[model samples]
Target chain A: MITSILRPPPIIARMAFFAVLLGAWEWASRMGMVSRFIAPPPSEVVPAIGLLYHDNELVTRFLRTFGQVFAASGIGAALGMIIGWWLHHNKNAGRAFTDWFAAIAAAPLVLLFPLFLVLFGRNASTIIAMGAVAVLPPIILKTKEGLDHVPPVLINVGRTFNLTRWQHIRLIMMPASLPTIFTGLRLGLVFALINVVGVEYLIGFGGMGLMIAELGDRFEVAGMYAAILFVVLCSACFFWFTARLETWLLQTR
Target chain B: MAVANEMISRVTLYRVSAALFLLALWEAAGASGLFFKGVLPSTWFIGKSLIRLSGDPVFWGHFSVTLFEILAGFGIGSLVGVIVGLALGMNRYSGQIFEPVIEYLAATPKVVFLPILLILFGIGVGSKISLAALSCFFPMTLSLAAGVRGMNPMFLRVGQTLNLSLMQRVRMIYLPALVPPISTGLRLGFGIATVGALLSEIKLSNKGLGHAAMQAYARFDIPTMMAILIVIFALAGLGNMLIGSIIRLPGPNTRRLTKDRT
Candidate 1:
């Protein structure tokens, strides 16, 4: 399997594939084969990215959005962990509440942004609250699954060793569940980011989403594309960070 | 026994009471005049508005547009996802080649392409459909791929040893194997596709449920906005229920079969 993966494709071939696509896009746009308004070539978009960077609007907006996502996901993860652990100890209560919550969670929570804005106002708070709400369900569901699946023998051994309830949870339950909890956190963060951007786009505030909207309103298609590319970069960075963390955790174990 | 039954009833009453209490607090907060009236319309006004809005053709028109986009996108996405998933699962070479590309695109927010699509397709049905398709595509593909990959290799070997034709093997093995994953993908796709449609409408379109919601916000029509919210939430709940029922349908012992192999 390792050898097959190594022999699958070369970096150069991948680069070539991307380059050819870009080249064709540029050629098509310049030749008026496709409307420049619709498909602004990467040539225009690439340079526009530099301008956006120098303007500092992109950085500022990105930081604001990232801050909202981090704050919301952090709060949601902590709260979900507490709730999930509590529910683990009380199965019936957990089952009853989780069923109700999951029903609510499956709904389009983004539609509640207007209500959120009314309650919290058009500030980072509203955006953060929306993100947190969006993030909570996955964390709760995953953590509950993780805790439920902990090995019975491990719990028996812990009890035999005279470990207290707190000790059993901290030493056995938490460690056993960490990997799955982390998976939930990863999903939660992604949802949080998506919700924050959507909310920001819907109700205008200064963020990357707002920047995309502003550019679209102005018909500055290139700038809009650049802002989107920045969002993509942020997402890539998120995935990379989480993957590394997952690997590190596995290695530590 | 009578006392125990009475206590159970009391507990049920308490649960209902808690919900009502929360609603009352919301109503009280809105009526307090501490906040701007437009920002926090009274619950009384929202109830009235919901009734009023339900009868309006304009609301239905917008809802239909959003619904059409979601349904169209979901149908197309699920079909494509299942096909691609099956192809990749059956072919090791193609699967290895395309896996990274799929993963990369999956992680990227397809919403980022909204502006470009709007420019290309105009702020009409085309753009909305495109956005919904793009958003719904990834999760469907991912779920289907996971499902396909998860099929027991022993099953395939057994089919091969029996000298089963490729089409027969696919019919007997792959199609049944895909049922659960494809169902799950469809469920996830529905929600994401709805969001994609709404997002596109909110961002660019002039007509749709999202546009109605945006218009309400812009005009500070709080009750109308709340009405729209209730509608969206109801539709989402309905969609989820439909999918859940489909998943729970009695089926061949596929899960047990797969479990044995694993």
Candidate 2:
């Protein structure tokens, strides 16, 4: 077990690298080489963490944003999968739809936030809708690609065994498509998280984004940095978790 | 004359049908009064706003500034990404040392640094450009690195057997191998660049399409805001299609290299 842990790299080395960077940042700030207003030292940011923790408002706002992300991702993933599956049934239609859909996917859907706000008002629902809409195309595109790429030979084999359509899909297509579908889910989750934070930032709904905006407005650089750090940490955790999930899935298969 | 009339009639029918369907729905929603007046602006109001905004020089000025920032950031990011990616791919030690750092930074949403950037760059076009570059850099770097690394080892071996010059090998082998990945990265990078530029403008700027929309929002001018939003979306969609087509175009080097290999 110890060797397994050490096999990757020495944790000390990684920690040392982070420490050295932080040390340089602290030194630069103290030496007036870098503006503290622009990049407050970790010393300032660390203490401000306590202030944010004690602020119940901040915690509640974060929870609301989290709730929005979860709802949007859940709904978007379900709808995307269903649509993808439907498209998979018709090859030519799937291709044609994807041709147009890819353009939509590549467009920055955040531009639609105004329309969303107009339709849904300045509320949590709007945030959720924005996240869902932003992520749906990626999820749909990935899911369709996943389903379409399942080997034709496998389908032929299934048919040879006299399997029903549902059975063929469940037993073969799903398993074959799981990796690609997971990729879409990961992308969707990231987009959902981004849209939630972004909508909150722009519309002034309470969240980490709101906290950042509020701190910026107040010129509390340290507090803003702390909030930004929190967001970065959350995103980093999501990235790591999804990466591990992908690895595990690949291995299990 | 009859054939020409038939073609025109079909096209007109399609356009009118879509427009009528949209207008009818909007009119019905507006008449129902189930939602706030601001929530569902009348089609007539939005149409008028769109035409009015199209004639505004101030709007055009803001749009141009935003476009300049996006394009400049994309160019800078793509250059840096390609250079760094090439270096990392060519040097194993640097690749190992820096790959984790790059990945970590990439995973951390760059938007988190917006406040810091605003402070440093004074909420100007510089800040927007910086944000756009940061947003665009990751995908390009990742795709380029993958492209370089994914080159078939057999190609290298063949080049070695032929004792080809370093430059010749690069021109004949590496460049072709890198094209697909570089194209993909550029396409993704361009899209992210637009988003970054727009988001920065919305968050801090006094000008640009995003600012126009934000101003409309503040004043409860929903129709004007919608029009700006539509314009921004159309621009972003066009950029996406443009970059995507460039990437999808078959490179001359790719065909030549593949033929040589076969």
Candidate 3:
């Protein structure tokens, strides 16, 4: 048993490591090594998932948050790509605005959420707008980077075929830049989700953020973990889906 | 050279005009009552509010509180990050086992953990600091680990040939090799840390610029809120530039080497 544990397979090693960590957590919580109010055991957290399902609107809440994420990121990604494309084609404009975009991207745009709330009137629209704006800069910057980095050889190949600018862009330019664009999309989506959930938490209404806030307020630590677990799962799913989609799209090449 | 200089000048001219045009459009929108009165405050109103707010001592108090949180959290996070990253990167098996976990955590919206932090640390500066540290930790760790892993074997061999002690090797060879990734991590970590700190403040805090902005929002003082946001933006921009300059000063050689490697 000792040898097996020591020389464990990769999968086993990962599982064993987490198991040990969780076991320690359980032990600490049970033995009063940590406060019960803050660090509830996995035992309590697991059951709290069921409680959330039964008493709280777990599924509906997740769906609502998910909807906002999709709407905001979708708008952001589309706008980002269009603007990035336009900038790539317009050298003067691109040169003029690239540094501005970089500065905006670096800024903590989430601080503008209150202004969004004021404009959009404290609803899901406010959250969506905030998320979209939060995400837009990164996607735009990344898209431009991707397009700019596409190999000159690829463009030459299109030119050798006597391709027009439109054809060349649709075929060679886009495909070459798609990977970088996908990277931007993933980053933007993460930012969007963070902003959306943050707004929900701040506003103290609607979705998983609200659930986490409410549970925390009620001092239901277990329920809060369960809600957070669902959010982590949502994030993992987003990461995995985008990764899979990128691989599939790239496979055609 | 002349053509390039002319092109740069033209670009700058266009950029300035574009910004002025945007301000003009905003002013026109406010004047025309395109939206509600307060929803789209005139640029002049926002500029006036910003000046007035800058003179207010209470606003400075909040600003100082936020600056303290940012610097303290970033300092703690970067120290822990570099140490842990170096340790993990030096070990082969540990890096494999843990890098994926950190990557996953990095991808997740760390704000979700803010509740746990709040519970553990109370509703004050502790939670905000923890949030900033947590946000900064992942990128820094990943960057340093990647740096250490990618270190050339020749460097270590040279250190061995010189009969250098482990501490000497670390100071002279390993540390210099890490400058590029350290700067990258600092740039990325600082950005995320600032966001995390401000977000936590916005969520629940009696002090900080975020709290001040929220107060303005609560009072339906749109102009004040806008002014506060502009302040935050300016501060964030300044921070980014400061990091950029600091990183660029010591980073050119290593950055060029990394660029060549890629």
Better of 1 and 2 by DockQ: 1
TM-score of chain B of 1: 0.87
- Looking at candidate 1 chain A, the ten consecutive residues that score lowest on lDDT are A4-13
**Native interface contacts retained, candidate 1:** 0.44
Which candidate has the highest DockQ of all? 3
lDDT string, candidate 2, B1-262, tens digits: 9977876676566556756887899889877888887677887788899899889999899889989999999999888888788777766555666666677667655676788888888888999999999888888887777677777777878999999997887777776767777878888888888888888888889888888888998899988988888788778778877876876576665754542344
Higher-ranked by DockQ: 1 or 3:
3
C-alpha lDDT of residue A126 in model 2 = 89
For candidate 1, write residues A1-253 as lDDT tens digits: 9975546464544556678999999999999998777778999988988888786477788889999999999999999888787667765556446676677667777767778887888898999999999889888888888999999999899989999988988999999999999888988888898888877876778588888778877888777777887788787787778778878987898
Model 1 agreement with the true structure over B140-208: per-residue lDDT tens digits:
777877777888887888899999998898788777766777777877788888878887887777899
What are the RMSDs of all candidates, in order? 3.7, 5.1, 2.5
TM-score of each: 0.88, 0.85, 0.93
Q: lDDT by residue for model 3 over A55-94, one digit each (tens)?
A: 9988898899989988999999899999898788799999
True contacts kept of each: 0.44, 0.45, 0.71
**Better lDDT candidate (2, 3):** 3
Ranking by DockQ: 3, 1, 2
Model 1 chain B, poorest ten-residue lDDT window?
Answer: B253-262
Give candidate 3's chain B TM-score.
Answer: 0.92
